[model samples]
Target chain A: MKKINLVLFFLAALVAFVVNAQPPRPAPTPNDTLNSTKVLKDGRVMFSIYAPKASQVTLSGDFLKEYKPIQLVKNDIGVWSYTSDAVTPDVYSYDFVVDGVKTLDPKNVLLKEGENGYSNYFEVSGPESAYASIQNVPHGNLQKVWFFSKVTGKMTRFHVYTPPGYEKMKGKLPVLYLQHGGGDNDASWSTVGRANFIMDNLYAARKAVPMIVVMPMGHPGAGFFMNPGIDEDPYYKQMFDEIMPLVAEKFRALTDRYHTAYAGLSMGGLQAMNMALFSPQRFGYVLPLSTGYFPPQIKLLEEKYADALRNPEINKLKLFWICMGGQKDIAYQNGLNCNALFDKFGIKYEKANYDAGHTFITWRHNLEEFAPKLFK
Target chain B: MKKINLVLFFLAALVAFVVNAQPPRPAPTPNDTLNSTKVLKDGRVMFSIYAPKASQVTLSGDFLKEYKPIQLVKNDIGVWSYTSDAVTPDVYSYDFVVDGVKTLDPKNVLLKEGENGYSNYFEVSGPESAYASIQNVPHGNLQKVWFFSKVTGKMTRFHVYTPPGYEKMKGKLPVLYLQHGGGDNDASWSTVGRANFIMDNLYAARKAVPMIVVMPMGHPGAGFFMNPGIDEDPYYKQMFDEIMPLVAEKFRALTDRYHTAYAGLSMGGLQAMNMALFSPQRFGYVLPLSTGYFPPQIKLLEEKYADALRNPEINKLKLFWICMGGQKDIAYQNGLNCNALFDKFGIKYEKANYDAGHTFITWRHNLEEFAPKLFK
Candidate 1:
């Protein structure tokens, strides 16, 4: 009787924590009642913030073509707001510029972490966004792995996405070294880029292969990207000397050329192209999104890699795909120049235009399209 | 040879992308030039924000008792500023209240994510903080694991911390099911609580047994805690029916009672206490930090578990440690009452006073002290 009662007591205690405790709540203020973002039924997004004493407020976001600041009107209660026109279905980063200062939405907890700062993000939901949206599909695991970097002389962190059923998988899986843009870090691809969700959706639909994606920090710190030239970059050394070996040693990744891929957006895209070109035997697929080499860099590339360009082995890569966010992409001219250089060297490749602009929306679309063609 | 030159070109491209890509920078405004937070040489921290138009600005943080908002002085440049006296070495969360609105520091990127909102945090370095600070020690991996919960009826995510060398370890490790307080989520313990860094430091010093720590979302959504009572709480059902089994299956966790422990803060603390008492044989170590059962709940506990309370096997557990943040803790009275009840029941346990209030600072100290004694 005592044992049975003890069992019942334990079961009750196990479940009781959630029910019993009442934490003290902060004194409610007038500002606490204001909703910061509202997604209307018609697809428009209305953003609001309470700052009665402010003289000026404006909204700055990536949804705008050039990140133009839109003025917000203040109401009688000192609440400033702006309702945007029906936006396309996608996730976009934004911030409020109040009296010349960049400010995050106080009401929105979801943030897009960048290298130097952070901004808030919201999704305009629709069928088009279903690929990257959190759905009913089995989810993957995103791990924040920190390792000491010999190249950087500091602890470097990276996000690794292991697909669903990874823990119980029977064998080693193909690997994709996915990277973010110049200003973003390891967290960008998984959070703002929604890479894991995209992969989860694709895998659930049987449109993409199950793989492990490693998203490493692109730049070491602020202004790290400003130092021109590949030889001068610490990430270059870190990738080959530290990151790759660490991933291979830590994860059950298939490191052979036929099972490996490299891909990135913008600056990351450039890195991807370089890795495939430099170590032609290491990767089966290469996808560079919304990025290309300058004409001078292309000329230097032709002069420097003439032998590798002419080598028949360079053609053995399963895919050398170039993706762009159409003509509005900032790197369109550079991409065209780089493609011309690829053509001049008789390099065979596939290119696609996914969207408009050098942003996550385009990159998400690029991944959605390019991922299905990999590891075949 | 064209092949060799192509290889060199690829190498150049791979390394060059980091060098060559110039992402467009946002036009710098006057607000961009001001530093938001400056940790002084004397340990006093100065915070500044460019908000020329705002009439009033105040700082709200956990460092202050009862979270009193500190008023900031506006200078000629319309910059609002505040200088805090030397703070003891610890991490603290803060936010700027502009006029009537709660705002984030535009200059600080590191944020502590909560269930409903986000706040920025800063660290004051000292010997006391060394244990939780990032040191030159082998780090562990923090993974965001999402799984479908039949109990919650949705996709539930939890943060799992696998200790250093876990991948190469030969045997299954003991598991600590750690939880955060109300209004916090799975990310809080790793971010603000510094649970990973604490474990890393402890492991490096050989003071604690290496183990896996799982921080699950304590509440499903907003106000889920207000529903009151164990039978009605979804998390109670979710914890036993789904989360525990999922962790054991996915992670290399030893499911035996001796290999399991439960700990939590505030509401989570109450839950931990319940788990240990309810299922006395399941967890060898039980820690409830800054929390206790209220008088009414104590009456229920006594009435519901009278037979189990009399059972002697409860005394066989290795450790039942209770921790509090001294008298200033919100739950101090309830903790005292709960202790009296434990004494009346002749339950053996150790208790510690770690700090002065109900916050992460106290919890961090409590974890640092309690972890070394686990799985012994």
Candidate 2:
């Protein structure tokens, strides 16, 4: 009788367990992930920019038809996105023509230099990719890029132009981080100015001193640094985070005030000045061609740069080349004021003036003239 | 009865003569009509390269995206022609990206200064639908151009940049006819160079002397009178027969030398020298930005310019400004040689050697500087 009662109790417990087993956890859903990581069988990369307000969104670039718009599809995030099929491996230029305005993709991390402003760059996974391996050119291997930054949301893109035979070469080449202005990305100097050809020609002719050039994009209205007024433009965030990490990761750049350097034109010039004054420990040389540094917020730029101006280490700057074209009256006048301030601050600097105004001619000439002065 | 029979026979013979009247000249077929008045409708423009035995041909320009392998359709005239409706309205800079290499169009009579050689230009029709109509702004007017030419096959392209208050206000504006180098159309100056903006800004700032500027594109590849390498390039015959005569008929231009003018850079400079020397009565002022009238075949340039070179009617010539940049070794050397030759020849010429190269900066500056000197 006692065994039978115990068996009855066990049976009741088993019955309850069977009735109350929690519903199997729901399988993972695509909507559950915020940042979608999708890999296609063919290997195309995809991302979406959610803008419910944008009536029309088209992806345009070196990838698609020249300036023709690429239409995007809508999703739950109110963001529009599209994925391209596995593209050939090469540096591709692209931009988002949102509505009628040209813009860079907000979601994609890669970017290139604009002819004058900033452009977007894409990397595709494929067997015949030139970008996959450092091209087997007869000379040097491309310096692999890597870095960590606090600015540009973290890892940022940067490239180095190593002199031919830098790998086989015994000595370090002088470094010139040539930057592109706003609306430009990393590839601008090479594409628009044909920097590679220029460098090649100069080196071939033995006219230009051998050097490693670093081209970075300096757009105020980019990523987290976006703003109309200069001081408000938060490129400082990128300067700290993205740019540095990549610089450190890529080429074996010299780590001295004089050995390390920065130079840019227009927005690029402003970037050079910001890098020069804000981080005296990192750079000794600064050539601002047709540009000057202002706190992205003018008031703040002046105030902060003022503090930098008074710093003792600032005087250690090897070269503060503030150059502009005579025709660029606005920039020239502004640059003149900056040069006068540099003089007042006793900053060792040189000012070179070209006959023309805010133009690439002046910038190219400035590079040719000023680059040779570094690490000499 | 005899009289009636004779009369009937006479009527019958006359009727037969009238009925058998020589078949009315076969109504000219529509195809022949179209060939005569080619409207360029299907919206496609033809780029013809007359290479008798070339295996392949292609057309390239800023118009074609990437200048892809545009296959050329052949003609019985041994002309390799390619048609395109792919370009947009505006001055597009391009070249014939022929088989594995780049070449200029053999048919289009337009050119511009490029990296090593001149680039080609093609114009897409504007919105006005009157082919191309000048847009009249508060400060200036872009005129509709039509001209009869003897240089390129038949009708040629030309545009005039006129300053504000010209139609209503009756003062002769010093005319400055700026020509593209070679391979570019008249629209090149307007599109890529933004000639209108340059003038508007200069004039608005009261920096430039207000004047009517004309851009005409017509140059043969042969001699002082034609192409420098006439035999080497096949387009020489087409250019001489078509492009020039049309420009002279299109716009209202000043007839006097002082009121009229001429200037260009590179091949354009060659054209400017050729035009002023060959057609001396048309241009009082000549500014060859970066050119030398010396192509072994330019005996005509020498012959025509010989009188102007010695005891030059300096006062009548207005201003013969010839200048280049200091760094353009080739151009500077050529310019310097010309200066010396001109000096030996007792030619009173105005010249400048700026600290730059034979690039657009120097050329732009040359144009900017020369404009103020015209009819001033």
Computed on C-alphas against the true complex, the DockQ of each candidate is 0.32, 0.00
True contacts kept of each: 0.52, 0.00
Query: By summed lDDT, which 10 consecutive residues of candidate 2 chain A come out lowest?
Result: A1-10
TM-score of each: 0.90, 0.33
Model 1 lDDT per residue over A1-376, tens place: 1111122233334335536654334446556677787888898888898777888998877677663578999999778999988788888777787766667787777788877677778887889788899888888899999988877788879999999989899889999989888767789888888999999999999999999999999986433342223465677788878888888888888889889888987778878777666666778998888888765667677877677667675688899999888887767777897888778888878989976576778888888888899898
Q: Per-residue lDDT of A1-376 in model 2, one digit per residue for the tens?
A: 1111122223333334445754333234333343322335676646455445556667654333222345889776556777876544434545554443344343333333342324445544454332222222222212213233334334334545666655346655556778865445565665444455455445654666677777654543444231122355556556545555444444445655677778887667766776666666677787888754332334454555566767777667787788886743235655666666677767677778865445444555566566657766
Q: Which ten contiguous residues of candidate 1 chain B have the minimum total lDDT?
A: B1-10
In TM-score terms, candidate 2 sits at: 0.33
Considering summed lDDT, which 10 consecutive residues are worst modelled in model 2 chain B? B29-38
TM of chain B vs. native, candidate 2: 0.54
